[model samples]
Target: MLRYVIDVVEMLDTPKTSGASLAEFLRSQGAENAEIMVKTIEGEEGLSTDFVRVFIPGSRGKSSGGSAPTLGIIGRLGGAGARPERIGFVSDGDGCAAALSAAAKLLNMSAQGDVLPGDVIITTHVTGWAPTEPHDPVPFMGSPVDMETMNDFEVEAEMDAIVSIDTTKGNRTINHRGIAISPTVKSGYILRPSEDLVSVTETVTGVNAVVFPLATQDITPYGNDLHHVNSILQPAVATDAPVVGVAITTAVPVAGCATGASHATDIELASRFAIETAKYFGAGQISFYDADQFAHLVSLYGEATHLQTLGRTK
Candidate 1:
C-alpha cells in the first residue's frame, strides 16, 4: 500500500494528470475484469476535468451473480491542483490519491488472485487546474464542476456502503496530523461511529482512533447557503446507503488549496483503513450503523430525506 500510495501521489503531482492517463495506468495495473470508465467534462469557465471510475469484481460479487454487498470508495475533492493560483498538487488531492491508490492495490491483488467477497468501485475526478474560493480560517479549492455533477458520476446505485475520503485540514477542529473518521451518515441522519471501522483505523495506524465532529449541515446538499465542514459527506445526500468520511488531517489548520501539504505516510494509512473496511464490509463482517437502531429512530421520528434536497423554495 505504501508503494501504491507513493506511486499515485507522484502521478497526481503533475499538472498534466488527467482521467484518460489515470484510466490507462489502472488498466495496466491488473484486474482484467474491472470496468473502468473515463469521462471528460468541460466547466463553465472553459476548464475541463476527467472523472475516472473503476469497478473491481469480487468472487461473490453481484456482477458475478453473488449477493455480497458492493462497497464504494469515493475520493471527494474540489480538485487536485489550483493552477494560476497555486502550483503542484494541493493538499485536497490527498483524498483522491488515497482512493485511487487503494484501487490500484486492489487491482494488483485481484490480478494475483486475492479478490474480496463483494464488488468494489472506486471513483474520483482529475482536475489539474481547479479554481480557488474563499472560506473561513483558510481558502479552499473550487471544483471545475458542481457538486451534483460530481455525485452523478461518483455515487453509484450499486454501492451498499461508501467510504468518502477528503482532506479536512481547512478547519480548526480535529487538530491531529493523521487520519480521522467521521460518524456514519445515512439519509440525513448522523448516526454513531461504527466500532468495526474504528477498530480498523486503530489497527491500521497503530494508535487510538480519531473521530471528528459532524454537524447537521455537513450532511445536507451543497449550494443551500449553509456552512459545511467540506464535501466529505456529500455522498450521503445522493443515496440511502450508509456513508462514512475518512479525513486527512493536520496538527493545525491548513488551506485545501495549499501545495506541498500532503503527507505520504498519512495517505497510506487512510488508504489502508479504506481497504480494510471494504474487505470486512464486503465479507458481511462489519456494519456501518445498527440497522435496527436506524429503524427505531425513523419509527420514532419521521423521514429525514428532506435534508437531502435544496428544501422548499421560499
Candidate 2:
C-alpha cells in the first residue's frame, strides 16, 4: 500500500501533469469509475489544473437503492507538484498523496473481495506550479485557486460526512510524528470530539489518538483577516455535514512548500488510518457526531450556520 502512495507521489511530482495521469494511474489499479475535470482558473499562475474524483461504490451502490451513507474523503493540498521553485512534490502534498493512496487501497480491497457497505468518494485537484505565501512562523503554500474555488469543487451534497486531510506542519500547535484528528465540526458548531474515531485511530496505530486543539474561529470561513490554524477545517464552512480534519503533523514547524520534506512512513500511517476509518464508518460502526445532540444545540443557540458564510455588514 505504501508503494502505491509512493507511486502516486512520484507521478504527481512532475512539472507537466494533470488529473488525467492520476485518473489513469487509479484506473490501472482497478478504479474503473474515476473521473477527471480540468478547469482553467485565472489565479493559479495561469496553470490549468485538473480535479480528480474517484468513486468506489459500496456493495449495494449509491444509485442502486442502497441505504448506506456516503463518505467524502477529500485530500486538501495547495498543490501536488510545486514546480519551478520547488522541483518535486512538496510537504504540503502529503494530504493529496495519502488520499490517493487510500483510494487505491480501497479499490484494491474491493477487487480482492473486501468491499465496504457504503460508497467512498475521494476528490482533490492537481497542480504542478502553485504559488507560495509568507506566514509568521514559516512560509506556506498558496493555491492557484482561492479557498472558495477549492470549496466549490471539493465539498459536495452526497457526502454524509467529510474527512478533510491537509499538511499541518507549518504550525507549532501539534508536535507529533504521525498524524492528528480534529474535533468534529457541523454547521458551524464545534462538538465534543468523537470517541469512536479516537478508538479507531488507536486501533489502527496501536497508540493513543492525538487530537489537535481547535477553537471556534478555526471552523469559520477562510480570509477576512482572521487567522486560521490551517486549511484543515475549511470544508466545514461549505457543508452542514460533519467534517473532521486528518492532519499530517510533524515535531516542528516546517514550511508547506518545502521540498524533500515528506516522510513516506508518516504518510503511510495517515493513509492506513484513513482506510480504517472508511472501513468502520461505512459499516455504521462509527459516528462522527450525535445528530440529536446537534439538533438540541441548534434549538438552544439558534442558527450558527452564519459561521459558514463570510461576515456581512450593513
Candidate 3:
C-alpha cells in the first residue's frame, strides 16, 4: 500500500488542476504505479508551499509491475495573507473524492484486466450526527444521546453509457439531483437525453440467478422523520437473462447532518442495509464507494470480471 501527502500552494486551484500536476510529477519520479497525498503547508510561503509525497510498496523495481500497488493523494489550502483568524488552507473535499474514485478505477484496471468501456462506477456520500455525551461514570451524570442518524447526501456513478431517467412533467420531488450527475457525465459517450433519476437494472447472462431483498436496516427508522424511504432493486427476480457478467454499484455515506449528528453511525446503518439487502437478493458480488474512498467491489462467488459483450452485435 502506498500513502502520499502533497501540498498545493495555489489558493483558487481545483482538484482536477492539482491532480494533473501531481500525476505528471509521479510519472517523472519513475513511479510506475504510485499513490500520492497532497497537502498545503500550514504557515509556509511560495517555494515551500506546494509539496507532494509518494508511497510505493516493496523494493523499487524498474518496471511498474510485480506487486499490487496502492496510492493516496492529499492536498491542503492556505488561508489569507498573514491574518491570525483568517482561514488557512484545507483539502478540497470534492477533488479528493474524485481523485480517490479515479484511483479506484486505476487499481481495478491493474488488478483485473481491461475494464469495459461502459462499466459503471458508483460514488456516494453519507453524513450523520449526534449530540456529544459527557464522559461521566455515573448513570445520570452525562447528557442523554438525544438523536443519532445518517443521511445520503449524494450518490453518483459513471457507466459505459448514460440512460435518461425522465422526470419531465411529473412530480418534481422525484428528481434525483445527486444521483443524476454520474449518468450525465457518462451520457456524453452514449447519445441519450437526460431525465429524472429513478432506477437502474442490469441482466447478467452467465449468472444462474439473482435476487435483492430489502435489508433490516432499510425497514428501520433512523432519526425523527428521517429514513431511507425508497430502494430500487435491479433485476427484481432471478432470471436466466444471459448471465454474461454482473456489476452492482455501492452505496455511499453523506457528510454533515442538519443537526450535527454522527456521520459514522449513519454510514454504518446505510452499509448494513446494503449488506443485508445484497445477501438477501443473492448478489454474487458487492462493492463500496464513499467520499474519501472510491469504487471497489468484493466478489463473493466469482472473479472480478468485466462485461465485454455489452452493446455488441453478433
Say which candidate scores most in lDDT.
1
Cα lDDT of model 3 by residue, 163-244, tens digit = 1111011112222212221211111011111221111221111222222222322222222232221211111111111111
Q: Model 1, 123-190: lDDT tens per residue?
A: 99998899999999899999999999999999999999999999999999888999999999998899
lDDT per residue for candidate 2 within 1-314, as digits (tens), equals 78988888888778866777877777776645444344545564575556777888887657457978889999998886667778888999899889888888888887777888888888888888888788868988888888898888889999999988889999888998788999899988889889998997788778899999998888888886778888899999999899989999999999998998998877887788888888878888899998899889989999889888887844
Q: Is candidate 1 or candidate 3 better by TM-score?
A: 1
Q: Candidate 1, 40: how far from true, in Å? A: 0.4
Model 2: per-residue Cα lDDT at residue 142: 87
Q: How many residue pairs clash in each candidate?
A: 0, 1, 48
The models' CA-based lDDT, in order, is 0.93, 0.84, 0.22
lDDT of 2 at 272: 87
TM-score of each: 0.99, 0.95, 0.21
TM-score, candidate number 2: 0.95
